[model samples]
Structures are given as C-alpha cells and as structure tokens.
Target: MAEHKIYTMSVAKVYPHYVTKAEKKGRTKAEVDEIIRWLTGYSQEGLEAQLEEQKDFETFFAEAPRLNPSRSLIKGVICGVRVEDIEEPIMQEIRYLDKLIDELAKGKAMEKILRK
Candidate 1:
C-alpha cells in the first residue's frame, strides 16, 4: 500500500462581509485570501512599533506616509481620497464626523410648548 499526500489550502476564513463584498466585486476566494495575507504581512510588527511611538492617531497618520496619502495594496488604497482607501485613520475620521453630526442633531430638537 502507498501512502497518499494531500495539500490543504492554508487560508483562514475571514469575516462573511469580506467574503460577500469580495464576491460582489468579482474576486475569487483565492484572490481574496491572497489579498488578506498581503495586506497584513510582517510589516505589522514595524507598524505596531510606530503606532506605540506615536500614540496620537493624527500624529501616526502624519508619520506613516505609506499608510497616509496612499498605499496601493492588494486589498485597496491605504489612504487619501481614493475610492479604495481603507486606512484606519480615514475610518476614524468618518466615525468622528458621524458622532459630531449626531451631537449637533441632538442639540437642535424642538421643545414642547405648554397650552394654558
């Protein structure tokens, strides 16, 4: 009897939203996996160090140029105004902007008037 050798794919399952979005964009499962791996590579360690050194998000954004104006990664643009931008700093900006809008809306509610 001969022993059989099998090669299983090493890609891990990511968020369903990612899979769905990737599929909707016409990307294959393999391509999506490769993109994920490439986006989060060994450079994560270096990014962590820099993130620690510059605790402020804006400061970090300023220092990390590659992740600032833009970085054309397999996933998307790493920053700037590009449609594919997926940088954390840009996400944070969006979040804060939403919160500001919510706060402004809360302050503009009309008060009920009492009838005599």
Candidate 2:
C-alpha cells in the first residue's frame, strides 16, 4: 500500500496551525508546546531543533527521544477518525498529537490535557 501522505509532510508545516488554533481559543503557544513535549518527550530545545530542521512526521516521530508511554491514554476522534482505532502506529501518534491539540483548542485544562 502507498504510504500516507501525512507521513512525509513536515511537522513544521503543521506546527503553526496548531499554535494558531490554540491561540484563537485563548490558549498559548507554550501550552501547545507543553502538550507536544508531554506526548513526544522532546524538550523545548529539541522540539525547536526538529522544527528548524523541517523534519517530516515520520522522521520527527522516529527520532523522538522517548515517546510518552502515557500517549496511549489519548483517545478521541480527530478529523473523523478515532485515534485509538488507527492501525498505523505513526498515524496513531500523529492523531494523538492532533487530539491533544484539539483538546487544548477546546479549552481543556492543561492537567487533564496532559493526562496527569
């Protein structure tokens, strides 16, 4: 089967949208960054490096220092698909991030969004 197009897309390409979504909803970029760090285990500096490098989603995820084990706790529909039901691991990871961002945009408390 052909690889999903999203796998090759740069995470940098989408990061701004996530930030904007949150910002429009009265959330801050730091909150978006925190959610990303919590899910991908990338430090603020490391996350910035990945963004600067324009790494594709596959590479971004592949090189993550430690994908949060608690990411599995993220479950919900994003763009019409339930994240937990996604069969592709990379896709699931992508959706997990999307779900978290969605929650942040929806004004969920940071503690709950981080699953703490």
Candidate 3:
C-alpha cells in the first residue's frame, strides 16, 4: 500500500490545528504542548526545533526521543476508529496524539488525559 499522505505531510502543517482545537475549547496551547511532550518525550526546545524543521509525521515520530510506553494505554475512538485497533504503528502513534487532543478539547483533566 502507498504510504498514507499524512506520513509525508509536515507535522508543522498539522500542529496549528491541534493548538486551535484545544484553544477553541478554552484550553491553552501550553496544554497541547504538554501533551505532545508527554507523548514524545521532547523537551520544549526540542519540540520547537521539530516544528522549525517542518519534519514529516514519519520523521517526527521516528526521531522522537522517547515515545511514552503508556501510549498503548490510550484507548478510544478517534475519527471513527479505535486508536488501539490501528495495526500500523505509525498511524497508531498519530491517532494517539489525535485522541489526546480530543480529550483535552472535551475538558478531561490533565492528569487523566496524560494517563497519570
């Protein structure tokens, strides 16, 4: 199968949507950044660098310093598919981020959304 277009799309292109989704629901960009940091283990500076470099989702994930193991615990339907049911590793990771953003928009507690 051809690689999903999202794999090639720059994370920088999609990142603003994540921030807007959270902000529209009254959450701060900091919260979205926190979730990304929690999921990918990128320090604030490192995260900024990733954004600055406009890395594609594939490379963004591939270069993640330490993808949180607890990400497997993130279970829910996102875009009509359960995140845990995604067979492709990269797609699953992408959906994991999407699901976290959705939770934040829905007003889930930060700790719970972080799976603490």
C-alpha TM-score for every candidate: 0.27, 0.98, 0.99
Worst 10-residue stretch by lDDT in candidate 2? 69-78
lDDT of 3 by residue, 1-116 (tens): 98999999999999999999999999999999999999999999999999999999999999999999999999989999999999999999999999999999999999999999
Task: Give the candidate order by descending TM-score.
Answer: 3, 2, 1
Clashing pairs in 1: none
**Model 1 segments more than 4 A misplaced:** 1-14, 42-116
- Reference-based lDDT, each prediction: 0.33, 0.94, 0.97
- Candidate 2, clashing residue pairs? none
Query: Candidate 2 regions off by >4 Å?
Result: none
Instruction: Please give the distance, in angstroms, between residue 109's alpha carbon in candidate 3 and its true position after superposition.
Output: 0.4
Which has the greatest TM-score? Answer: 3
Q: Count the backbone clashes (under 3 Å) in each candidate.
A: 0, 0, 0
Q: Candidate 1 overall Cα lDDT vs. reference? A: 0.33
Report RMSD (Å) for each prediction in the order shown.
20.3, 0.6, 0.5
Candidate 3 colliding pairs? none
